[model samples]
Target: MEETRRPRLAWKIFKLFLVVLLVAFIAAAGGVAYVWNELQPPHKGEMVSFTIPAGTSSRDIADTLETKGIVKNGSFFWLYLKYKGEGARFQAGEYEMTPGMTLNEVIGKLNRGETVKEETIHFTVPEGYTLEQVAKKLEEQNAVSATAFLQLADKPPTALSEVLAGPLPTDNQVRHKLEGYLFPETYEMKKGSTAEDIMERMAEELKNKLSAIPDFDSRLKARGLTLHELLTVASLVEKESAVKEESPMIAGVIYNRLKAKMRLEIDATVQYALPEYKERLFEADLKTESPYNTYLHDGLPPGPIANPGLDSIEAALSPKDSKYLFYVTKKDGSRTHLFAETYEQHLKNIEESKKTAK
Candidate 1:
């Protein structure tokens, strides 16, 4: 009877131990379900705007999100980041978030830097614009002070020194040190960009454009022209060309004249020497006593007269193979030119051009 009592007591003790084990398992399962539910997106809140300052830590970001009601739990978000090994990949910027966004969505936006757009100002610098003209345009657009832009252009930024393919011309008569280096393009900058910033951006664009051309270095070398000279010739072509298709032919004419050691006698150079552009140039204008006046000078002008576009640059590098040394614009409103291999033929073409005016 004592042995029977011992077995029954043992069974009761074993059964009580099984019940405690079952209760612990149920409690553990409930705790896991609660945590998982808390981790999900709230999916019901207005959009919130925040800034993640530079060098902000992931934990701080998580806390900011929780405080803004973008997340249900900062600690859980922090843990999630750690689990995914992505805490260090967040970027700093102004962000807009809605609470409905999931954990993955929030993380993706931070990593991709989907920031709020700031106000920007855009201005276009057309091809063949002189440095002075560019400055004036900037002033008109209220982008930068014209005086400041000109002063900065006079002494170009040192950062641009590396971008140049050759040394900057030190000629006193070269109007501006950065005349032809600034590429012509529409640029967008922050509302308060400085003159140096704009100039540097334009110069860097020129460098990038040159780099994009196939075998540019070899083409420049084969032409036996320095970067400065190439720009000068390109500027000439740009000024002479009213028709884009005629640029290469005009470039060839300039090259032939240069090879023959003849004065360029370009009307554009004379116009550049004048204080302002004139619709019609006179003999006195051609006789202007400036180094930029190609009619008076023997070689390329002191420097490029204006910023040239890419087509003109390419024309200068690879001029059309022609013996033509002269061109006269047609008076027929077509903005085209007639080419000539001799002065006599040029005179005839000039007469023919005049006939079209009537």
Candidate 2:
């Protein structure tokens, strides 16, 4: 009886051991499956870019990665980093990521500092640049094809929405549909940006800048000028006043001539009518029959001749109090202009300018 009892006890002990081993194996298999799932890609093959700003915390990086769908679980990533003692290994830079990448691959890229470097181009539109000239400048930067830009200018896309509340010039003589709407400024654009995108950005900038002007609407109403008319006058002022200080004075001259029902006779207006810029306008050039020929028109031209800068736009809004009716660019290489209240004085300044030129 004692021997039989000993055999049963041993068999029972062996059965208990087998049961424990099976339980341990199942637990280990479950843990392995959980870890494999955690290491998988968050999504299918979709590439994305993210910028990790300086001094970002490990938890913050996890949150960003999760938000961008690059990681399956923020907590999992955090725990993995803590487990590997790699929480301090992440670098700050622009990083390109893909959903197809595993957690280890993502963390390895960040550890290796494999960041993406982007190229940008800067294009400056100077004050008083015509739409054509602006297009040419963009072409030089490879930002846009000049021909495509010009075509868009003629028939601007409806998607090219801007803050211009006023209608375009009704005069059939307007050269480009967006001649004076594109604000002049230096802009930094990413590589391979579209001409439409660049133009839209500039137009939005113009809207913002114009909105900041104090009492712009009241001043426009007081002067009986529409937004287009104001831009036209500003463009003229921009071209005529090389010296920024003379912007208001040139504006005054423009107003004086317009109020008197006299021809603007602005040289810049003639230049706009010409196919090409001319330092000197001949009698035949002035006779070119175009609505932009302010020398032949009685009042402001049909539309703006060029895109004006902030100073020129401000001068148009707040012209100086003066009786000046004429102005001529000085030839002393100072880019200064002589202002006069009488035609005789204007002729005298012209003569002086010629002498100074010699």
Q: Number of the top candidate by lDDT? A: 1
Cα lDDT tens digits for candidate 2, 88-190? 9899999989887877788899999899977988999998999999999999878899999999988878778544545555566788978889899999988
**TM-score against native, each model:** 0.87, 0.73
Off by over 4 Å in 2: 1-75, 78-94, 97-117, 162-166
Clashing residue pairs in candidate 1, if any? none
Worst 10 residues of 1 by lDDT: 157-166
Residue 3 lDDT (model 1): 98
Model 1: per-residue Cα lDDT over 1-358, one tens digit each: 9999999999999999999999999999998888898789987778899999999999999999998888899999999999999879899989999998899999999999999998888999999999999999999999999999999889877786876655889888888989999999999998899998898889889999999989998999989988999999999999999788899999999999999998989999998899999999988888889999988889899899999999999999888989998999999999999999999999999999999984
Give residue 4's error in model 1 in angstroms: 3.4
* Model 2, global lDDT: 0.87
Error of 2 at 312 (Å): 0.3
